[model samples]
Target: MTIQEIVDKILAYHPDIGDRRTCDVIVGADPNRECTGILISIAPTVPIIRKAIEIGANFIFVHEPTFFSGYDDECEWLEGNDVYEEKLALLVDNGITVYRDHDHIHAHRPDGIFHYMMKHLGWLEYLKPQARGWEVVLPPTRLGDLIAHVKERMGLEHIRYIGDPDAIVS
Candidate 1:
């Protein structure tokens, strides 16, 4: 399928997006290009772009900005920057298309990121729905243990917390 078709499919999954302005957009390459393969990632780093090129994938759907700005599409300030120029050149030269799906993914039912995070952390069963946002209710455990569990489950090397490690949490 074409890049635009794939993007439309993704947007269709989030009907609530409506006509709202979103950060989700094609940040590089041609949307009309036929997709050889697809790569989904948290960000479009140099390594990620290289991987896409190596894998013969022309379409990259990312959860974050391609450029280092809040809005990935705006690059007037990044024109002379070496890193930005290099990254942009890599995308353009390699014909790699990048689409940022931040806002719509967050607007998804059950919230795409949170739902997947809870699932990956094995906390889906403990999820408690609230009026504003959801919460996870875990069994009483020491703060240290909870931190360790989160780090392991999320494959994070280290995390910073403000509370006493020995304090019990639920």
Candidate 2:
């Protein structure tokens, strides 16, 4: 499919005509298109943007802002923001197409990201994935073992903590 076809598919999945100012359905490139290698990312950063170029990715689907912050704020476009500027420049210069799947991907019953994470972590059968998060049906295990398992499975350096590390989290 071409760019137009891809865009149509996306809209078909999530038909909400949202405000452009919101990042809900921002397309850094064209919407309707088919690309050779599509780049999927959770956020758009300088490295991620360049990585797309290095990989010769014609289509990019990013989860976060390439220029702005927050959910829907019109991105700050001033030149003072060096990092953001560089990222945008790469896209413009290379004619890369970028799309954010925030609104559409989450529309799936379990959300694409949830299923992706679940599958990657080998927890699909044990968890009900949702757009917001997930629920896991797990057998009994030691708290320390559980923590270590989660940390290793997620490859997380530091997970958010409401209390001390030694505090048992359920």
Candidate 3:
């Protein structure tokens, strides 16, 4: 598939929310070019771009901005910056098409990040689908135990909560 075809598929699946068309765009390279491989990532940093080139992937579906700015036309700050130019050059020279999927991915009914987290933590069975996203009404348990459960399940070493350790959460 070409980059444009992949982008069209994403839009068909997720669409765009209301007036927020800030994301879901091809930020770099020629979208019509056929893709060799696709790399999906949360960020399109220089290292990630280089890694994509190394892996022979010509399409990068990034969840964040390719350029330094969120606003497309606000790249004046990046003008003449060596790092910015180098990154742009890499994408152009390597024929890498960079598409940003920030808003649409989150706006999708299931919420991609939430779905992944729930599935990864074995909590999908407890998921309660809502208009916005999935929510789980966990049973009452001590805050400390809840924290521990989250830490263990999420593979997190540190967690912060806004309640007493002894407090029960429903």
lDDT of 2: 0.66
Best model per TM-score: 1
Off by over 4 Å in 1: 131-134
Rank candidates, lDDT, best first: 1, 3, 2
Worst 10 residues of 2 by lDDT: 161-170
TM-score of 3: 0.77
lDDT (tens digit, per residue) of candidate 2 on 2-95: 6556656777876454555445554455545467577788876767778888998877777775566555236555557776666666776876
**Can you write out model 3's per-residue Cα lDDT over 46-125, one digit (the tens) per residue?**
89999998999999988788887776436778889998888888988899988887777787668887878777777777
User: Per-residue lDDT for 1-170 in model 1, tens only?
Assistant: 89999988987887576786777879778889899999989999999999999999999989989988768777899999999999989998999999998888787667888888888988888877651236678899999999999999988999999999999999
Best by lDDT: 1
lDDT of 3 at 128: 61
For residue 54, give model 1's deviation from the true position in Å.
1.5
**In angstroms, how far off is 71's CA in candidate 2?**
4.6
Evaluate model 1: give its lDDT: 0.87
Clashes of 1: 0
**TM-score (all chains, Cα) for each model:** 0.91, 0.69, 0.77
Clashing pairs in 3: none
Task: Assess each prediction's global lDDT (C-alpha) against the native.
Answer: 0.87, 0.66, 0.81
